[model samples]
Target chain A: MQTKIQELRKERKITQSELADAVNVTRQTIISLENGRYNASLILAHKIAQFFGVTIEDIFIFNEEEENL
Target chain B: MRGLFCGTTARNNEEYRKVVKRRMLTMTILIIVGIATAVTAYMAFHHSTSAISDHTLGIYSGVGFGMAASGLFFLIRDFLLLRNEAKLKQQRLEQTDERLAQIRDLALKPALFTMLFILFTSCLIGSIFYPVLIYILLITVWAFLIVYIIATRYYSRKM
Candidate 1:
């Protein structure tokens, strides 16, 4: 899973720690999400989306072939 | 390496450096103490004055050597880990993560089930051989369960 978390956070001038605090996750999780090494759980995805004022789909790019068909 | 310390600000990096320093100091102290105890025990065992003293020295040596061996293992582990500050930072990040707690609980389910199975089997076998052992096992299990419940409740509330 690829995420626009780094881009969105940078645009908002937010640090990784601040974003992690907002989403109740560790900075490592945010880093992992940005690096596409780890995918967020549904609840965490929802929280991150809400923090960035976006939909989950907007922040997380899921390849149709890889994720669905 | 990339997880905790990666991309940290200067302030956070300095804080982690202090933490790593403290950890290294503590581990070093433990290793030194363990070695001293082991050496003392070895000397006492070798220079016993009488039979009773020899038996006491033997027990002391066993305990001291066990502590020293475990301490050495931990010291080596800490040395390898702390040599790279980034790895320690990453470890700290993982420890603070809430997802790890949930994963730990999930992992414990299988371990708990296995422990219960073993305890049950042990109790059954003990009943056939020496019924006294069954009572001891029952008490031990009950105590362990109580402690586990208390710890779980405490951590859940605290976290």
Candidate 2:
């Protein structure tokens, strides 16, 4: 999965910790999410979507293989 | 604050070490306090052959018992807290184990851990207690399980 979290964060001029606070997760979680080290839960996806004032679909893009699998 | 990223390096061992160390420290402190209490009690009990005045014996006995009891309580609290923390850590690890697959019991891990820890610890400690504390422990454990079952089920369904 690819997330435009960094792009959105940069556009909003928000720091990782700031985004994490908004999403109610630790800064490490935000960093991991950005680095693609792990995936976020659906609830967390919704949270990020709400924080960014966008839908989850807009932020996350699935690879073809991921989509097929 | 130790490097936030564990880099897939197993953190379970590290966590287990910390908990074991804490329990060891708690047990050591309790033992020291127990020894001091025993020494004081012995001194007071045998200071003289003269039937040890009820007043003096009573005072020393109360002091010794109080110290020992408080020490025991601290040990028990530390054990309980460590047990709770370990359970949470394990559940969180399990929840975050794999993103490739969804697990049905993911949401239930934390509640299961809390209830099981409380129940097991209570039962274990109760086996050696005044037996009255057993009732209180059982009540607390049952109430916790009920509240937990309700809250988790509600969230899992609602979400």
**Candidate 1 C-alpha error for residue B6, in Å:** 20
Instruction: Report every candidate's CA lDDT.
Output: 0.73, 0.66
- Per-residue alpha-carbon lDDT of model 1 for A17-47, expressed as tens digits? 8998677567877888899977788988998
Q: Which regions of candidate 2 are displaced past 4 Å?
A: B1-159
lDDT of 1: 0.73
Taking all chains together, each candidate's TM-score versus the true structure is 0.50, 0.36
The candidate scoring highest on lDDT is 1
Q: Pick the candidate with the highest TM-score.
A: 1
Per residue, candidate 2 scores C-alpha lDDT tens digits across B1-159 of 121222132346455546445655776676677667666667767774655676766776677667667777757655665667645454334334333123334545776788678777877787686667667777877897799899999999999
